[model samples]
Target: MFDVIIIGAGVSGVSCALILGSAKERPYALNKKIGIITHQKASSLQTAVFNNAYGIPAGKLGSELLEESLAHLSSTYPQVEQIEKEKVISIEDDKTFYKIITNKNVFESKIVVVAIGAGNPMTIEGLEDFVVPHQKVPAIKNRIQLKNNDHLVKDGLYVAGVLAGHRSQLSIAAGSGAAVATDILSLWNDGNHTMVHDAINK
Candidate 1:
């Protein structure tokens, strides 16, 4: 079983994976297994341009940013498995672990983060209860989000990114992902707050 399985490969999901799989003093430092499941399609893929995202060069294509992020995650954290081309269908709570069912395969993990964007309505079986009208981005009437407390849906379950009711902004989504990872790390550290940072070797 994986230590953490993140659903969705958008900015939020990838950012979470990056932190969980980083080579610093944290999850990766502890050799935790991280997995990401996605169908390779994120709302950012359709974005024409990204000029408002922080730290990103102006006039960059949203797709370019996502591609670069994925590439960095893959190359930097080779141990973090990217379960590509798979669409998560449902998530089953199995007491001590979660059974994530996808169109291609089934995965089990100790923790799960749902960062699927709010571009479409959530259809997962056990997660529909948390679905609520998105407070932001009113232009998209069909968009919906999941109710969460600082990205925590319950023990071992979390919601991030747009699905967590955050604005549909790249920086916000990425930050949310990192926040969730930090929370998970804290749990692993016996409730002590944990932070991951890297500095140049001098």
Candidate 2:
């Protein structure tokens, strides 16, 4: 069983998993097994341009970011499993954790982050049979509305990137990933975690 299962290989999903994978001192990094399930490659990363992706100058290829990020993840978290070319059918709550059933395999995890791009929504038959119909869908604003300061769409279910409404932009999507990761860390730490700030103390 994994500690976390991210259902996308896009920037948001990768960013979230990267943070946890690199946090060596944190429980998630040290003890958790993280999984990323995706069909083919991240479509956004393949075709996206960095126009609005803050800090990144225009004209840079999105594929570059994808390659660099994947390289870093592999090096930093060698154990991170990437399940490619598989489409997720549904996510079921198993009381203690979540069961992510895909076309080719099944995964169990304590937490789930749905970061799939908004442009392509998965068509799962009878998804209602497993998870509650809580996640929002295709329409721009229909994306899941996360609870303030937390990424919990519902209990163990979390969301990032376009799934949470920030679509098409890489920077915002990555930022959303970081936000969810921070919240997940807080939850895992029994809500005892504190946010960091670089601003000078008054």
Each candidate's number of clashing pairs is 0, 0
lDDT of each: 0.84, 0.70
Query: Looking at candidate 1, what is the lDDT of residue 18?
Result: 92
Deviating ranges (above 4 Å) for candidate 2: 27-29, 120-150, 194-202
Clashing pairs in 2: none
Query: After superposing candidate 1, which stretches have Cα over 4 Å from the reference?
Result: 23-29
- TM-score for every candidate vs. truth? 0.92, 0.77
Best-fitting candidate, scored by lDDT: 1
Could you give candidate 1's per-residue lDDT for residues 1-202 as a string of tens digits?
A: 9989999888899999998887344543477888998666645455668788888899988778667878998899878899988988999999899999998788999999998888666767789878888878685466788888889988899999988998877899899999999898888888888887887993
lDDT of 1: 0.84
Measured over all alpha carbons after superposition, the RMSD of each candidate to the real structure, in angstroms, is 1.9, 4.8
Q: After superposition, how far is residue 79 of candidate 1 from its true place, in Å?
A: 1.3
